[model samples]
Target: MPVFGLHIRILGVALAAFVVVAEVAYADPTPDFFVLLERAKAAPRISAGEAEVAAAEARALQAEVGPNPSLSLEVENFGGKGLYQGTDASETTLSIGQLLELGGKREARIAAASLEAQAVRAQQTRNTSDFAAELAVAYARAEASAELAKLTAEAVGLAEGDAKTTRALVDSGREAELRFVQASAELARVRAELVQARAAEASAFARLTAFAGSKTPFDSIAVSLLSREPRATAVAGGTAPAVAVAQAESRAASAKVTIEERRWIPDITITGGVRSFASTDETAVVAGLSIPLPLFDQNRGGSAAARSEALAASLRLERAQSEADADRRAALAGLAAASQFLSAQLEVERASAEAYRLAQVGYEAGRVPLLELASVRRSLIETRRQTINIRLARVAAEAEAARVTGRLPFGE
Candidate 1:
């Protein structure tokens, strides 16, 4: 018996220590939203966009370089029957040739490539802005889910207390048995809602951690993003990233048109070399110039195609500007409407909370019926849920506004 007691005491100590360690491990502080945003900036998709910009810059540099010189060697009159059969009768020539571009073709190419790089850079900017907005929306959703879980858990606790109180009253012959049954049913319903809310919270956190590219998933955010008020600043359409991208593409297309128009100008290839005649035992310097006549292909079709593309680009730019204006206006309007709705919902939540408290007091005093108290409790829960949804809607509208304005969502 003494040895058995010793073993039991040892096991109890080990279990207590394990429980303490588990609690400490699960007590990690919530993650900061700004830190998560920084991590998201380094995500693979954003890095891919940066790589595209680098590649475009490299292409621009390549366009600035002139064509490489060509070297050639020719041996003549050496493979023939009589004089070409002997090395003494052979003629050898070594030459270096260069193509001299005309009609500012090289300059045109450089301009076009540089503008193309600018367009790529603009597109990258737009992509970064869009991703930031998406991350903000994800963060908001996670925070909202967390809030919903907390609210549901509180409702479950209240429902459990109500059921216990009704059971006690029924046992004492104050409340009827049916009242206790109703309270138990309501408690079960709130418990089920709590389960659903927790599942949604887990899913939202998973999405948030994925967006942040975190190896260890976060369970909660440090700050409540849904609680923050959205900024109501007016954004200009001209300053939007989409409009900037379109403008850059339009300029690049115009540069392409210039390149195609200059394509009809012939380039001159100049060759200079030394010729050796073995029979005469002599060497001479020779130079030649070759020009391609634009007889069959004058690049007229290419020029026409480039012009058409440029026109299309111009139209796209105009469309982008119009869409940006409309989108910004719509986002601002949505934000305003959501703000108004959230304000009203907050008032409703307060009123419902007060009414539930009074109903609980009255039911305990035997002045209020179980059904009336349940109705008030349900109203409070629904009002709180609606408030959460409204807050999320407001955050989404703000994120959209920030995206259209080329600003980071929920960022300074």
Candidate 2:
């Protein structure tokens, strides 16, 4: 080979290797949402944060009441008195004392802390529910988009085959030229629709990735399909979100009331010492009770605040119950409706398949017009797509109901 030709061949080989490596290095562009959900469940980051807050509150509640003991030593208040000659003046005094909380204040404080911990932990569980619901929405959307694309692909194939057949018949002087042109035009229009459908699919996939908080898109995922919409044959109750927050608030409010009641009580302190004034040495003992008198400030405002909060908690619980009932009814209705729709689509699917198969056989046998065959092909594909969509919607509805009511209509 000529020297220049050898260089060109070597460069082509290098380019091919580079292309292969690039393809191999390429990662999925979409995020795997199911994996992310698993991560969220395992880490339960919200729960962890709640746990930390609860721990802090518990520590505060358990903290022993009173000023931590204080210790002091003095020789006339310091080394500045070092010049003193008398023993009494030279002697240093040392004392240690601790303040004490009164009126069972420590126990009340601890109780309040415990309530707060419970509230936070409940909030964490609610967080999990919210995440799960959101994941369901994204999954549903992706399935919808994929179904749309599948339908469009089927339409394009049908249209293209018809156009080619018509063109061949026209060339043989067996079909009108206008028919061929019409078929080709329909094929072009359907192909454009297919492009849009794929774009929609991409958009849905991208959104799923964004919601999942993942670095790489999922390589592939298998989604559960539903033959019918979700229906709760069983009585439905509220999901974890409503239940958790209500319980948390109620516990917290009760805790606050107790803490407020303890507020009126005061703390105390004790100390002992020796004193010398010029002529005689004397030992002195002091005991004191620090009583917080509520004459001017009886904590009425705080106690009232706690009472209001407790009342609010009651209302919240009631509201959650009402919402849950409504959700259950809506979900059950949707499932029943979806089931009927799926049944209807089943007939459409079977009819379309039979029509397409018969048309294909006739077209090849030169026993049918190309336009008829093309129409059947497109109808079959579109029908299948529609059926897929119906099934996907049913699954989505079921998932949504399950998520809302905390139980599947039929069962998880």
Q: Give the Cα error of residue 328 in candidate 2, in Å.
A: 1.8
Model 1: per-residue Cα lDDT at residue 29: 31
What would you estimate as the lDDT of candidate 2? Answer: 0.66
lDDT of 1: 0.85
Pairing residues by index, what is the TM-score of model 2? 0.75
lDDT of 1 by residue, 176-282 (tens): 89888778777766666666676677767777777877666677778778888777764433388999999999999999999999999999999999999999999
For model 1, give the 10-residue run with minimal summed lDDT.
20-29
lDDT by residue (1-412, candidate 2, tens digit) is: 3435544554555454454334324346333444456654544454466667677566655653445787766566223444454554445556666677777777777777777777776675666665666666666677677777777887877777777777787899887888876776677667666666665666566666556655555422364333333445543554546666787788788888888877877666665555434334554443434455667987888999998999899889888878877776886788678778889999988988998888878876789877687777777777877777777767666766766655423355
**lDDT per prediction?**
0.85, 0.66
